[model samples]
Target: DQQVKQNSPSLSVQEGRISILNCDYTNSMFDYFLWYKKYPAEGPTFLISISSIKDKNEDGRFTVFLNKSAKHLSLHIVPSQPGDSAVYFCAARPGSQGNLIFGKGTKLSVKP
Candidate 1:
């Protein structure tokens, strides 16, 4: 069974808006969460991450929030642009393994 899940397959946003992507995981042992963005025919690139110790982490226009109790997380992009349009994935790392478990991904479209 998949431990990480992205229930939304896609999301749309207008230019200069805010975009939100959500993820949920069943494993309580997950100590770190990351979000990655990908373009067509390209590998995903790291965006933002959050540790279980903190509830939120921000970098520039991107922010990741983790809720340990709910076993959920989310990524927020402020002033979403057309360049931000891509496939977004949520991933988690367990306390022991360096390997990451990834979600299905959500494709975000930013229209001008």
Candidate 2:
């Protein structure tokens, strides 16, 4: 079973603070991890990604870390802004088709 789990269905953060979201996976075959940000009624856009080969990856305000041993991953957003409010999904792929198995999602709300 390729189930990716986001324990927190939602999170709230004050503007300009750091926001952290967590995810876990049950499939050991999953080696590539990705995080996607989505707004209402729109497709998710890729935020950051990490291969099983690496433990951490970062891009400006967003960072993602993967722990292969624990089968867990997390996304961090610093100085969270109101504009950053949206649903975030964690995904994993086995390095072939690039087809993803997604977590239910975590909705982040940044209050101004």
Q: Compare the candidates by TM-score and give the number of the best one.
A: 1
What does candidate 1's lDDT look like per residue over 1-112, in tens digits? 9999999999999999899999999999998999999999999999988889999999999988888999999999999999999999999998856799999999999999
Candidate 2 lDDT over 6-78, as tens digits, reads 9999999999999999999988888899999999999999899999899999999999989988999999999
TM-scores for every candidate against the unseen true structure: 0.97, 0.94
Candidate 2 weakest lDDT stretch, 10 residues: 94-103
Pairs in steric clash, model 1: none
- The best candidate by lDDT is 1
Alpha-carbon shift of residue 13 in model 1 (angstroms): 0.6
Compared with the true structure, model 2 gives a TM-score of: 0.94
Candidate 2 clash pair list:
none
